[model samples]
Target chain A: EPEVTQTPSHQVTQMGQEVILRCVPISNHLYFYWYRQILGQKVEFLVSFYNNEISEKSEIFDDQFSVERPDGSNFTLKIRSTKLEDSAMYFCASSSILAGVGEQYFGPGTRLTVT
Target chain B: GESVGLHLPTLSVQEGDNSIINCAYSNSASDYFIWYKQESGKGPQFIIDIRSNMDKRQGQRVTVLLNKTVKHLSLQIAATQPGDSAVYFCAENDNQGGKLIFGQGTELSVKP
Candidate 1:
């Protein structure tokens, strides 16, 4: 089965530095999303993208964060300045609207570590 | 180190036994409910889902029951195996963006 794929299974960066996390959602899927989990905490929604614009976002997705579907298959999340609190596992997910009411598929995730 | 579910609940079952995980959702407007499994170092994997119009849905060796009146959802696994061990989460789908709001997870441990 085709699955969502993310790059750099793990990322480590210094506080105040910029970082970009990349994902390739399943082909032909129109909707994409980003979620995060703080260590052993519940998964939290960050942002959702569709039609090349953000449709919904959580409070955690502040101005420091931005998402772009730079190409047909690539979706990326960038942080202008990383904070220590930004250290968490970032997950990318996608689903097809054409399929009508199906579940989203998730990537393995990118573990972000800020020092 | 901080623990993810130090305060969360856990269920232990034998390999041949059945396991049932439950969740109490907070959204009444949410029409879509889903159950996901997350192992260590992995993202949430979709197991099964049900719509608000239905109360019961079943998959391969897995069944999901939803009580919209009480906003409760449960996942039942029959003849649980060692591979069934993981943290299980329930999520409600947003109306607009296909975003999911996840619930507190339950740890399931299957002993062989």
Candidate 2:
């Protein structure tokens, strides 16, 4: 199975610092997404990327958050100014165009700890 | 400490027993649903999915049942094993670019 992969399994950054989380989605996937899970909470959608543009985003994805597909294989989420509340497990997911059925392959996730 | 999967609804079952987890979704427009399993520190792994037109879908030892009328979804694990211990989440898709909305997960503890 070709699974999504993420770098820096764990990230620790000071408050107000910039942090970028990287993901390499399945090679053939066209749609990408970002989500976060606060400790002991349900997963929340952050943003979705397709064709090098943001397709959809949640309120949680505010001005501080941005996503970019700098190259063919790498997708990244950058938080301009991290806050304590930004500390959570950030997950990147991808799916094929037949995504009408909504089966997304998720990476192991990057644990972001903002202190 | 607030660990992942720690505050989720939990079900304890003996080895070889069958486990059924239920979920209630709020969206009537959702046309797709998926079941995912998450280990303590990992991301959600896709297990099985069902389209709105289908009432039941099966995969390996798992089965997903969907009821569009009541907006309910259920995952059935047959002859559960120790490795099946994890948090299971049911997610609904709004049919818009495959964005999934997850429900509060249920923790399954298969006692061996």
Whole-model lDDT values for every prediction: 0.88, 0.89
DockQ of 2: 0.64
Candidate 2 clashing pairs? none
Query: Which residue ranges in model 1 land beyond 4 Å of their true spot?
Result: A98-100, B1-8
Q: Tell me the docking grade of candidate 1.
A: medium
For candidate 2, lDDT tens digit of each residue in B38-93? 99989999899999999999999999998888778899999999999999988877
Ten residues in sequence with the least summed lDDT for candidate 1 chain A: A95-104
lDDT of 1 at B106: 93
Question: What is each candidate's DockQ, to 2 decimals?
Answer: 0.54, 0.64
All candidates: TM-score: 0.94, 0.95
Interface RMSD of 1: 2.4
lDDT of candidate 1 over A9-45, digit per residue (tens): 9999999999999999999888899999999889999
- Report the Cα interface RMSD of each model, rounded to 1 decimal: 2.4, 1.3
In the range A2-109, model 2's lDDT, one tens digit per residue, is: 999998999999999999999999999999999999998889889998888999898899999999999999999999999999999999999887466547899999
| lDDT at residue A115 of model 2 (Cα atoms) | 90
